[model samples]
Target chain A: MNNIALGRYLPLNTIINKMDPRSKILILLVMMITVFLPAGFIGYVPILIFIATALYFSKLKLTYALRALKPMIWMFIFLLVINVLVMRTGTLLISWGWFKVYSDAFSQTAYIIIRLTLMIILCTVLTATTKPLDLTLGIEKLLKPFEKIGLPAHVIAMMISIALRFIPTLIDETNRIMNAQASRGVDLENGTMTEKIRAVLSLIVPLFVSAFDRADQLADAMEARGYDPSATRTRYKVLKMTNVDYFAMAFALVVFATDLVLCWI
Target chain B: MEAIELEHLSFSYDGQTDVLKDISLTIPKGSYTAIVGHNGSGKSTLAKLIIGLLEPKSGTIKVLGQTLTDHNLKAVRDHVGIVFQNPDNQFIGSTVADDIAFGLENHCVPTKDMQRIIEESAAKVSMSDYLNAEPTNLSGGQKQRVAIAGILAMSPEIIIFDESTSMLDPQGKASVNEQIRKLNEAKNITILSITHDMEEAAQASNVVVLDQGTIAAIGTPADVFQNDALMSRLRLDLPFGLKAAKAFQAHGIEIDAVMNNAQLVEALCQLK
Candidate 1:
């Protein structure tokens, strides 16, 4: 559980890591749209090359991207099976009296898997290169414009940052509760369905109680520190877009445009 | 001017039963005062009231000579900071640097000066090296230190510790206590520590014992600790030094009532 690396930052001094998180998040968004542009297998050559170049420059291995995909492997397989069975369009590849396989099904599923794999890898790259706090700042900056539409951007950003801050603490609390329950003659593993549910409820009840208690204390602490949501607060760590950030954003936009043009062709 | 003054302050979660009733106290500026009490004795409630986290049911609370009102609540909070008992909950930042930055950001400190202020504050708490470290990776002591650094960044004149060291280990408690002492003596910042540990309270310039939400006794540690009946009735133990002195007196050795271990040690050494 501790080794979950989906959004873990890799502390390195590479250029990709130095790029502004705003630019990286924007690039990820552009790439996500580009991946689904119906830009056939031939068009994916440049996209894959771009990703490989990114991974190389970011000082990250292909395994990091593959690791992000590992948890979703079963879901991908399930999707492939469902698509293969449901879609009845293209050239027939195999038939067994109502059981049939078609070329289009394989091709479509391959495109979907490729698209999903690229999206996941792109997301992984963004997270791996950017610190979580910086990512939150970038998000807050992006959401600032939406605040004009009555959106509580600062509050949302604070919530995200606080939630990120407490993730490890809550994880530890969960483990502690589990251990406490285990010691009290509660069999969490090999119990009957009802017993297992009861065991989980015991863990959840204490966790929820503690979480509420933590929230209450946190509110007091924030208040004591002079936090007023409506007041104007300055940024301590301001995000500045540098030359590298601009170049990266341009490169991602060009790649996406090229992919769209390829689809039209 | 006093750092904090409470007059006729009373509070209750439900209006029927009072948690704190007609409590009045004054904490002089630059003084270290410890509010000690058993569970549900309203020590924490008093701290919260002084910091304006909770409004008293009826009474006036003044901080830095200014009465606490809804209009000036933010201003009052700016001059007063709190380090809560649960280090994990009070830590509002992903990293030590960011945590210190939280209070400064709220105060609208200029970006140009934030880095310098944060570094100075972290240095004060001896957490300069761990600025980039995540709170999760830190021990309870380190987290409390970072929390102190957070309050220090704002340069609050008075800091209220709502049992901040209660959840820490003995070493952690000692380090935090040492920091609190330094802040009071060196920086001349007023300190109000609400603690269950009598030994910690003994080190304060003054100790206020609360029993059932009323002030049972208030004086210097030595003066208060001398009243054995009051200490027992309040379910408060004597400081380690005082307790040890009493035991020595029982065995035909006479020693004056000492407030802390160092005083007791010195007295024992001088007896020869």
Candidate 2:
């Protein structure tokens, strides 16, 4: 369970890691949109290069980036199989009784796979380079404009950051609960579906009880520290966009513009 | 000026029986006071009431010479900070630096001054190195130190520790106790520690013993620990030093009353 590295930050002194989280998030948004611009396979070359450059500057290993894709391999295979069976537009490649394969099937599957891979890689790079707190702050600053429409941006950001902070603690609690239940002869593994669900309930009930208790204590602690949801509060870690952040943002925008122009042409 | 004053304070959760009854206590400025009691003795409730976390049914609370009211509650909270029993629950920040910045941010301290204040507070608790570390990466003691640094950054006049060290190991407890004492002595911050450890209470300048939701005894640690009848009734044990001293006296050794192990050791070493 600890091996899950989807959104874990790597503490390294690098240009990508030093960029402002807001700019990083914006760049990520631009990259995600660019990947789905209806541009042909040839149009993805620039995006792939941009991602490679980002990965290089982040100082993160290729294995870590690929690890984010490990959990989605099964889903990718499922999508490929579905596309192969459904799409029959292009010239026929092979046919075996009821099974059929076509050129467009492979091309369409490739397009989707490329888009998903690019999106996932971009997200992983953002999370790996930026601390979770900074990500939350970036999201909060981005959402501030919506506050005029009655959206509680600060509260939402607080909830997100708190949830992220408690993930490890809750994971530890889940393991402890699982162990305690296992000691009591609860077989969570190698059980029927219904029996497994019942066993999971035992673990879940205790986890929920502890989580709610922690939340209560946390609320009191926040109150004691003078946290008023309605009150105006200052920020400590201000997000300043350095020249490099601007450069990163401009680079992402240019790539997106290039992809849009390719699709129009 | 008194750091905290409670007059005829009474509180009840379900409105039937009171958790704390007519609890009137005054903690003077710059004093290290310990509130010790059994699990249900309402000592924790008293701490909460003083910090304005819980509203009293019938009483008045004053912090730093200002009466606690709805309008002035924020002001009161600004002067008082609390570190609760569970280190995991009270840590609101993802990292140590962010946690220390939490209270300062709440009070609207400018971002420019916040960095310096956070560094200084982290230095006080010897956690400057771990400022960027996550809470999960910290031990129970380090988390408490970070929590203390969070409060210290706010520069509160009085800090309440509600069984803060009860969840820590012996070493963690000792280190937190040392930090609390230093904050009181060196920084002149008043400390009101709610603890289950008599040894911890022995180090305080004054001790308040709560029994059945009332102040059973309030005096210096020496004066309060000397009441054997009351201690027995409250089911509280003596500090390690006094316990050992009594055991030594039982075996034909004359030892003077000592509040802690250091004094007991000194007395034993000076014996002819």
Query: Which runs in model 2 stand beyond 4 Å of their true positions?
Result: A61-63, A92-102
- The prediction achieving the highest TM-score against the true structure is 1
Residue-wise lDDT of candidate 2 within B1-272, one digit each (tens)?
78988899999999999999998999999999999988889988888888787889998998888988888888889888999999999999989999999999999999899999999999999999999899999999999999999999988889999999999999999999999988988989899999998998999999999988999999999999989899888889999999898888889999898889999999999988
Q: List the residue pairs that clash in candidate 1.
A: none
> How much is A250 displaced in model 1, in angstroms?
1.6
Candidate 1 error regions (>4 Å) = A95-100
- On lDDT, the leading prediction is 2
Query: What is the per-residue lDDT of model 2 for residues A1-265, given as tens digits with 9 covering 90 to 100?
Result: 6866647888897998888999998898889889989989878998998999999999877777777787788988898889888997999999999988989988998888888888888888998899888899999999999999999999999999999999999999999999999999999997899999999999999999999999999999999999999989999888889999988888999999999999988
Looking at candidate 1 chain B, the ten consecutive residues that score lowest on lDDT are B230-239
Reference-based TM-score of each model = 0.97, 0.95
CAPRI quality band, candidate 2: high
